[model samples]
Target: MLVSIELVPRSKEDLLRDITIVENILPQINVLNVPDLLRFDLRSYEAASFAYSEKKDFNVIPHIRAIDIAPDAPLPCVDRPEIKEVLVVAGDPPPTEQHEVYPNTSVDIIKRYQKEAPHLRVYAVFDPYRRSPKEELEELERKKEAGASGFFTQPIFDTNLLQLSMDWLRDETVFWGISPVLGEKSRRYWERVNNIVFPKEYDFSLEGNIHFAQRMLQLVKQQNDNAYLMPLRVDLGAYLTELQSFIVY
Candidate 1:
């Protein structure tokens, strides 16, 4: 399986530091939700520079959030010519003092990218657990029609849920699954940072989460022969080693 890490770089220095860390761990790394609240700058020049630097040393894939695909937005080809593919997500809007920015839908961005950058393959993000099987399949079809070349799913803990969604969609497009590892404290931090509201009795821990990830990975490999594991927010080297032992890559 090809392993990759996602980084949210808040500044140029942060971007550089992320690149260095990524190079030491995975052979390829993707910058997720770029130009969004975390990165904030998605101009072609800036993206190209980051892409160039990342490509010079490591395999870096630049991401394009849905909000960045404005009708009048310029192409990134001018600056970073090496960026051949982009992960298009309905990015969160600018956060307010009290709340986080909700992402606009991704269909518009997929359409815009198809019209503007024909050579760049677009990837659309989907959360299977967030919707019913029918709804998930419907969204995937919509995105495919809008010119998305592939689909990436949110972090999933339940394999049965994933299988049901995949069975319903029956799509030929590439599907990337995310598995995030967060300790108890980190999970709480993420919830607060993203303003995620959960049940009052919910509990989040690294041990339980990693166990869930392993189970999901097992089922995914058992059901889909072509599925590749994509571990997020953790050490790639360690995850890869564990996956190598578990999955028949």
Candidate 2:
């Protein structure tokens, strides 16, 4: 099973510091994913290129918002030889409405990439909480038809939800997302903003989060699927150390 870790691109210095931290848990992580935050000056592909050039074996996948690119324009990574993969998302609206955004959906961008940047593998977003399983499955099929190579899902706090999503997407390449909800505020953000459904016995401590990550990883491995870790606001090294230690391979 492949394991991927998500990183935010704040600045060159901050991104490298995180990469150095990730280096401590080498061999356990197979890929690094950089998200394109609108507020951040450094683009996801730029950060990914930096990491790709710095690391020898590790793969880098950058997120690109579909709305940012013009419908007729080619994908951003066409000239970036270092970035081989990208995740297409129906990105959040810009902080200011004065900023323009394209009307293109993720599917539109995926097809665009397929035609223009065939060398780059495109991954689409999957949000289990946004819609019902059947609806989300249909959306995923549409993405597949648009030439998405794989999927990266939203962070799942419930195992049952994870299993259902896994069962539904059994034949496809899926990176099940897992993240830590450290405090009450973070938990509320997930519940109120993302609409995540947590288990009744969900524990909100670091130890609890580590234990949940372990279980999720073990189950993902058992199903022969990949796992994506989004250790938001947490200690990446220490979290991975405890989580990866529990995995057999």
lDDT of each: 0.56, 0.88
**Candidate 2 at 116: error in angstroms?**
1.0
Error (Å) of candidate 1 at residue 11 is: 3.6
| TM-score of every candidate | 0.69, 0.96
- In the range 43-121, model 1's lDDT, one tens digit per residue, is 4335446756655644344556565444555744423466666777666654554443334478877776688778887
State the weakest 10-residue window (summed lDDT) of model 1: 27-36
Candidate 2 lDDT score at position 114:
92
Deviation (Å) of 162 in candidate 1: 2.1
Please give the RMSD of candidate 1 to the true structure: 5.1
Candidate 1 lDDT at 242 equals 51
Residue 179 displacement in candidate 1 (angstroms) = 3.5
